[model samples]
Target: MSVSINKITVLGSGVMGHGIAQVSAMAGYNVTLRDIEQSFLDKAMEKIRWSLNKLVEKQKLSQQDADKIFARITPVVDLKTALKGADLLIEAVPEDMNLKKKVYAEVDSFAEDKTLYASNTSTLPITDMAALTSRPERFIGLHFFNPPQLMPLVEVIPGAKSNAGMVDMAMDYCKKVGKQPVLCKKDVPGFIVNRVFIPLVHEAVYCMERDNASMTQIDSAVKFRMSFPMGIFELADYTGLDVIHKATVEMHMRDAKVIFPHPKIKQLFDEKNLGQKTGKGFYEYKGDKYERVNLTEQEAATYNPIKLLAVAANNAAWLITNGVCDRAELEKALKLGMGLKKELFATMQEFGPQNVVKTLQELAAKYGQFYQPDPYLVSYRA
Candidate 1:
């Protein structure tokens, strides 16, 4: 069964919503971008125009095509007008669940019964959001990373009651929009990327704050040893420490057992010195470029990128044990969404799950339960 998503209604004209609308328009869909105010829509359109123009300048698309794509997007301030005739409605509002649920309620009232619903929530569970809508089965999760036009990966998550066909349709729609879709298999806090990535970065922050390692050592070790495109701190800075902190805080709310960033991270967030955006983070992003180099065989062997990986793998194990996703899907989400370059499971295999468990055990013993291996993992290792 396929849903005809020829017309798309995207709520919120913020960064993610505008980019999603642009991608939908570019994919030849009639896109209605609705925000509370016309000014927001205007600013979003200007940003989209600049983004589209970049594609034209690079010769990725003809100017005519760009114009046509821009022409397909209709910005509206009225909610009912935007929701009318929209076959698919994507709620891309703020990360707050109440705000998202309110939008879902409004859209649900206005949207047609056949209108498939999806949330662009990164961490919030789809099941909780789906409960607000009239059509739970039609509701799913279509999580797009920041800069939807540039990032290729979209997580296709099915809520507890989401229809199988809707999940498949969401996946197909993702491909139609020039995105590579990965099935989340189930809905959980942070889904896949945030589930693992958040804890990984939090550990990096803790590692630095506890004087376990310097920021430079942490960055160099991961970049040189793990073959990551961005070091944890550098990526946090690039992603905005505030954003990372918010994700951690929200997740920590869900699971208090999860280790959060150190007080220093909160201090930086409080200071509004949020990484690249504010021009300073772990490393000042002051027109400086990172030069990553590969380590020698012996250096690579000794370079233990173990701590963060242990946190990630523990989360992975938790998700797997809960039947949220199997090993294959979790690994795929981590590799593609996090840009690990190498296969995650294969890397875990090389490291030995037993060893990962041991590392987690040692870390937990030294610090606390956050480092403790997932119960499933500890058993698996045994």
Candidate 2:
């Protein structure tokens, strides 16, 4: 059966929630931005208005169109009212299974029998959450990147029991909202982007600790040599070290062999020096606003950026051989999700598969088995 979603009910009015609601409305869907308190909803509305105004000022959106889009998003504090006539319910609440189960129960009691359920969880397994609902087949994962209003990538993940039609509908829904959807065939921890991304960032930390490489040089090499939008350490600061620590710990818990929880990251997370939000992490920021890290071309000479990209390539290879996603989708995920200037596989090809594998092997010997080259990567022709 084909699934059609026209009305979206978004639970939680925090950053991700409001962004998702704003984009859905921009895509012409009637959206209900809901929160437990009116104040939360009010704040979300203000943020939405501010974002729309920015688009208008930049001429990306007309004032008339922005007003129309804002009008389409109805802010509500009541759960039942928000769920009323919603074709899809996107749960963007805090990442707690217990809290999510309670919300699902409430949604089950009020939502229409036909309403499809989607979780915007970045770390949790979709299958486990799907099991909490009566309609596990209707439960799917739509992991949007931070600031969904601007980020184009969305991981469309399906639980073990998710209906095939519903998965397709989720992908279509992403495209409708101006997102490039990548299917994470299995409900693996971290899905596609995080699965590959977490380890690459860890390698940066490893380089800093073991190789005694300066953070500025490492980031400079990554941005200048690899054409990455930001340096790995710089990205950690932008994303918040606490957030990386949490994600690393969570992913490591599920797959200990693949993910290593760096002591430095944990220490920062423990200390609450979260990143730009806290005015410090890998680098310092003033007034809680982001400032681009100053890196010179000469600094890029100190490090070989392939060391980090090799980690991502190996992880991408594992995902391919394990049937999580194919090569094309993996490349697309890295490019759009991570904002890489070049395709990851293309870069791997430039390094040559044999050399990439050799680097991983060398890293594995130096580090732990986590850097061990996967069989797929070893046998890769290109």
Candidate 3:
């Protein structure tokens, strides 16, 4: 049977849920946002109205267009009522496995037989979530970034039992919602972005803990030298160190191969330095004012943003060489999904794979196992 996502039912009415509903509605899909309570639903609707008005003010959308989009989104407190005619159901609930499984089981009973079930989970294994449904073949992970209405990337993760047709339908739906879709062949922990990013972010924390760099210097080096949108420490402060700490522990429990636990993360969480949400973290935020922690010049230079970036690029290269994904798709995902520059890889390739492998090996010998060259890189040398 062919599947067409003309009507989308989005479960949960939090930031991600409301944003997803907005994008789907803007793309001409009728969206029903389901929440457990009227108060929650009202708050989501209010946020949606504010978001649309902001878009109009920015000139990115017309007031008339925003109204049409807002009109297409119907808020409901009942799941069955909201999902009655949905062609596709997207769950943007909290990333607790039990909660997700419970919701999926309910959705399995309430949604249409042909409805495609997708999760916006960033870390949990999609295969595990698919097991909750009778029709595992229809389950897929459609991981949209924060502010789903604005972020361009949507990872299409296929669980082990997911139907090939379902994958195609999910990809088509992502494009329909005006997103660039990248397929993940297996349900790896953290999918793609978080798998690579979490480690890099953790190492940044390690750099701080060891007195290798101060928060400001470390962040400045990455932002200015590597052109990263923000320094890792700054991003952690904005994203909340506690949140990253929880995600790191969850991911570590799932896959112990990568030891991403950092003392800084644990200390911050223990001390209740939860970033902007809690008023302090790597940096302090007091109302509208911000203050960065100090660092020495030598500590700043020791972090080496270029070398760290090269490690990431090397890892990506190994993934591409091993057929995890094609070069173009990997490049596209890193560029569009992570907001990284494409030229990083192009420059490495220009320097040659052999040179890159040697550089990685030297770093591995010095920095520990994390920088060890993958077999693909070793094979390139052979």
Candidate 4:
């Protein structure tokens, strides 16, 4: 069956929620932005107005178009009002499994059976929350990057119970709302993007904590030699160390055999130095300024990224073998979503899966640390 998503109900009025509401409204969808209190709704509207103004001033949007877009979004404190006639509902609430389940239960009561439900969760599996809904076939993971108005990528993760039609409709809806959707074939913790990409960030921190390298050297090497615009450590500071720590904990829970950068990241989070938000993380920020670390070009090139890339490749292989996603989709997501050079995952395949294992072995033997090899990679020699 085909679905026409003309009305979008966005649950939550936080940064991501409001941004999603704004984009959906701008796309000609009648969007209802809901929150528990009127204050949250007001703040979200304020942010939306500011964003629209900036776009208009920059000529990305005309004032007349901005006003029309702003008019399409209706802020409501009532859940029923938000859910009524909503062909699609997106939950951008806090990342908690049980809490989300409860919200889904509430949404299920109010939303029509035909309404497709999606959660913008970054870490939890779509399967976990899908069971709570009577319409399990309608549940999916629409993991949108932060500031959804700007970020074009959205991972369309279907649970075991989700139907093919649901996935297709969700993908269609994503394009309608101006997003590039990637399918996470199976409902696994962290889905595709976090499952494969975030591990590299963790590995970078682990290398730092394990005395394998200094933050300065790692940052410089990543920036200058790895062909990446920003180092993982520095990116963490900009994005949020607390967010990274929480995501690591969630991912680690799902795959306990894997090692993560918990100790150091958690320490920073607990210290209330949650990256740029608090003006300190891997580095301190003082009034939009921060110090720089320098490394020689030769020294930077000598610093190996393969140590980090190995973990990502091996984990990606595990994901592929487990049916979370395949190599091609993973490559596309990494390239389009993260703006990474195509060589990262391509090299992983070119280097052979066993070479990933070999890299793991070398790292473990030298540093006395290694994640248990995925069973899929163990049996196959190729």
lDDT for each of the candidates? 0.82, 0.88, 0.77, 0.80
Please give the TM-score that candidate 1 achieves against the real structure: 0.91
Count of steric clashes across candidates, in order: 0, 0, 0, 0
Off by over 4 Å in 3: 209-211, 288-303, 347-368, 379-382
Check candidate 2 and list the clashing pairs. none
Q: Give each model a TM-score.
A: 0.91, 0.96, 0.89, 0.90
Query: 1 or 2, which is superior by lDDT?
Result: 2
Give the Å shift of residue 260 in candidate 1: 4.0
lDDT of 4: 0.80
170 Cα displacement, candidate 3 (Å): 1.4
lDDT of 3 by residue, 194-260 (tens): 6656777776765566546566777766665555556777777876776678778878888775544
Determine which window of 10 residues in candidate 4 has minimal summed lDDT.
Answer: 288-297
Which ranges in model 4 have alpha carbons more than 4 Å from their true place? 288-299, 347-357, 364-382
For candidate 3, give the lDDT.
0.77
Model 2: weakest 10-residue lDDT segment is: 282-291
